[model samples]
Target: MNYKLLGKSGLAVSELCLGTMTFGNTTNEADAIEMIDRFVDRGGNFLDTADVYVSGRSEEIVGKAIKKRRSDIVLATKVRMTTSSNINGVGLSRKHILDGVEASLKRLQTDYIDLYQVHVWDHATPIEETLRTLDDLVTSGKVRYIGCSNFFAWQLMKSLAYSDASRYVRFVSIQPQYSLVSRQMDREMLSLCLEEKVGIIPWAPLGGGFLTGRYTRDEPKEGRMTTKVGESAWINRASDQNFSILDAVVEAAKELDKTPAQIALRWLIQREGITSPIFGASKLEQFEDNMGALGWEMPTEIWNRLNSASALQDDYPNRFIEKFRRPFE
Candidate 1:
């Protein structure tokens, strides 16, 4: 497995990070352990979880799975997703940040988190308060690095500028939903991260299994995309545009003799500024299939074909600026 430096940090992480969101949920303890073992055996050292996943059972399962090799793993988790009903139980306030980390550390059975991220933006709290609290976590050695997730371009920049001016630890990475069907990140977040040097760790890299090619246009598939028995699911992702992207992935997979999921994941792995893609699986076989995304490069022609199929349309100022970009170029 090839590793990349996470943003400007010296720490190196695997290209594909094992996501534990399904752990202790659809994935049983035995299956979760098997998947974790196989991932580590295959040279994967990065794992991601969160306090809010399965109401904290996911973190407990992950902690038990990696306790023996804890030192060798780059474990990451998040906060600010309403872990409790208390008035001060959530958000990025200094009180919540401190309380959240203490609980996360205890559940993960680790002294320090490799990377602690805010799960989402909290507009109620001041950005300064959150940045300072995260800096204090780094100062106290409770967190090795800080990151933000699901933040808009302006929110992220505001936090970074505050960190720089206040001389606090800045966010080194971002976790956003990015995949063949979900190119929304490309609209603005992608370029912002590239210019700011923040590593992009894409979550739902397979479009929540839409790009896996298991679900059909008419027939529902047996996967996470399902809502209930005999229930059509992921209707929002069933647009004609996404079908075209899926067909493109299938064509590339056929030529490469790989699965659609692997090709789709490889597309993200090859994108600029992407540090890693957090992939999850309920069964060991699924884990094995996704791990195949590594150890090879996609052919340029096929890569471009998939890229063209999933290209995002420029809007407003982007279209306006592109007309004048040639002068600067």
Candidate 2:
């Protein structure tokens, strides 16, 4: 139930954010409402949804669920995905951002968004155009902060540089897919966020349920891995290395008498520079299990064990640069 300042901003948010991507989809409206209630009862006040989630149904459900305590919640949502048949319905162009924010505000039943993020990089639009539009949102009181998701290190740096030079509102947070099984961020994005002072609210902090100890190496279950066929496909994430990391998590769970899901989440919560890890559930039980990730600290030995199991191999400039470091006298 601890709070942290989001990036370098004065805004304080809970260490764990409730993700509503499954609301009105796998989870019905009633269950979603209950989950939000429990989350708030447990001292959580951050909620994340995207306009594109379930064709905006998720936003609608979240809007209804939090109507009573709107002032106490930090709401975040994203744009930049195809929302309609119109040719100008997508991307970070000024047209789309302006249109998207208006639509998001209506669906969320809120006058302003706590954080409005571009879901991904829009190469078609000039960075300046996107930055200016986001700046306008802040200026107009429609958005309090801006952020980006699924961006490369260079893309984020480019946006930050543009914001600094143009005197625009800089991105204060980033939402990346990070977990024990997905350490790709460790390669570059991690260092970039650490240096830039940007908060990281990691999506899929449990590797789309991979680190939840629900799946086996040889048998894929009836969850996203078996049903969805995208970047999170079983073929893509069921590699030997990832299984080893899962094994470590399972071992830690057994030793500590906690679920593998909690172990995996605690690992991310303890990682330096992680602001909050967004977790969602289709059932109330799943949400309750994830809540176990809080209330206790993971022992250093278990944390190190998971870290070593999932550490990515050093490559190129990182390895080469490490050899030249000199000890301070």
Candidate 3:
């Protein structure tokens, strides 16, 4: 319900960005509109979507859902995903950036995007060409702000440096996967965003529902870590360590009189420089539950306890520096 300035931009967005990836996939367009109506009723004004979601159907529903309140919402959409198999159909190349924004604008039924983000790192394209095109969008009044998603610290920095040198539109935000169970961003990207003034709108803030406690120690579902994607890339593995972290989350949730989902979200909100997270929900109840994270905060010690349990192993110069500085102590 609270609004924070998005990065260096003067724009204000809600503490929770309503992500529409699940809108057109699991639910019909009508239901998607209903969900958005409920969200806006709850004081949420920020929406995040991607052109590639549901092969553009998601954007269509989202566009329609916000028709009555289009000017009131801070709408964000992403590009760089493969929308077509053709060589020019994807990536952050000038052609794709230009084509993709037009497609997204058409689908969203908006003349300008609140935020236009590169969906992921496009290694094939030079940073200059990609950034230069984003700059053009800003000049053309097609995009208010720019951001990047699923990018590493180096890639983010590389793009920022390119933008600075060319006087192009600097990325005002960075979206990366961050959650209680997945603290990889804490190592570098978070710090990079802090230093560079890039607002962080973390996606998969619940580790794709692993932290939701539905995948209990005894039960694993076909939804997330199971038959579809997991059967290939993921192991059916939650070691004692992972369980210990889950247990701590459950314990804290009980102690705080909140659900595990709330505890997970509250943990992120407590982090410095976190503008908001683009949390996804298939069910209305799930969306309502996530709202609890904003009403109050976990005590500092409890926050640190949860963080310590799920923190990632230090790497590189950080690992080397820790020996000299003793960060844990």
Candidate 4:
């Protein structure tokens, strides 16, 4: 239930952010509302949703759920996806951003968004054009902060540099897919965010339920991985390396008398530069299990074990650079 300042901003948010991507899809409105209530009762203050989630139904459900305590919540949503049939319906162009924000505000039933992020990079539009539009949103009091998701290290650095030189509002945070099984961020994005002082609110912090101990080596017959699509596909998550990492999590859970979900989440919570890990639950029991990640600290020994098990393979210039630094150390 602890709070941390998001990036370099004065805004404080909970250690865990509730993700509502499944709301209005796998979870109904009543259940979604109940989940929000329980989360707030447990002292959580961050909620993340995207306008494209479930064709805006997720935003509607979240809007209704948080209506009573709007002032106490830090709401975040994204744009930059195809939302209409028209040719100008997508991308970070000024037209799309302006239209998207208006639509998001209406659906969330809020006058201003706590954080408005571009869901992904829009190469079609000039970076300056995209940043200028976001700057206008802040200037008009429609958005308090801006951020990006699914961006490469260079894309983020380019945006930050443009903002600094143009005197525009810089992105204060980023949302990347990071977890014990998905440590690709460790390659470059992690260092970039750390050096730039940008907060990281990781999505899929449990690897889309891979680290939850629900699947086996035989392959999942059902659940998200069975779809064989996106990052959570059976092909992507069924690798031998990921299973070894999951074994480590399961072993830690057994030793500590905690659930596998808790062990995985705690590792992320304690990792340096991780502001908050966004977790989504389709059921109350799942949400409760994720909550267990709080209220206790994982022993450093176990933490190091999980870290070593999931560490990314050494590659390229980084290995060469490290070899050179060993003598100096």
Write down the TM-score of every candidate. 0.96, 0.98, 0.94, 0.98
**Across residues 188-210, which tens digit of lDDT does each residue of candidate 3 receive?**
88888888999999888877777
The C-alpha local distance difference test score for the whole of candidate 3 amounts to 0.85
List the candidate 1 regions with Cα displacement exceeding 4 Å.
219-222, 228-233
**CA lDDT of each prediction against the hidden true structure:** 0.90, 0.93, 0.85, 0.95
Question: For this target, which candidate reaches the highest lDDT against the unseen true structure?
Answer: 4
- C-alpha displacement of 115 in model 2, angstroms? 0.3
For residues 296-328, write the lDDT of model 2, one tens digit per residue.
999898888889999989897889878887776
For model 1, how does the per-residue alpha-carbon lDDT over 1-329 read when each residue is reduced to its tens digit?
99999987898999999999999998998999899888888888999999999999999988898899998899999999898899999899999999999999999888999999999999999999999899999999999999999999999999999999999999999998888888888888898888889999999998888888887787465666666422125666778999999999998899999999999999999988899999999887888899989899998888888889999876988898888788657
Candidate 2, residue 328: how far the Cα is off, in Å: 2.6
**Candidate 2 lDDT score at position 86:** 100
Residue 4 lDDT (model 4): 93
Q: List the residue pairs that clash in candidate 3.
A: none
- Give the range where candidate 3 is weakest over 10 consecutive residues by summed lDDT: 228-237
RMSD of each: 2.1, 1.0, 2.5, 1.0
Query: Model 2, stretches more than 4 Å misplaced?
Result: none
Superposed by TM-score, candidate 2 places the C-alpha of residue 19 at a distance from the truth, in angstroms, of 0.6
1 or 4: which has the higher TM-score?
A: 4
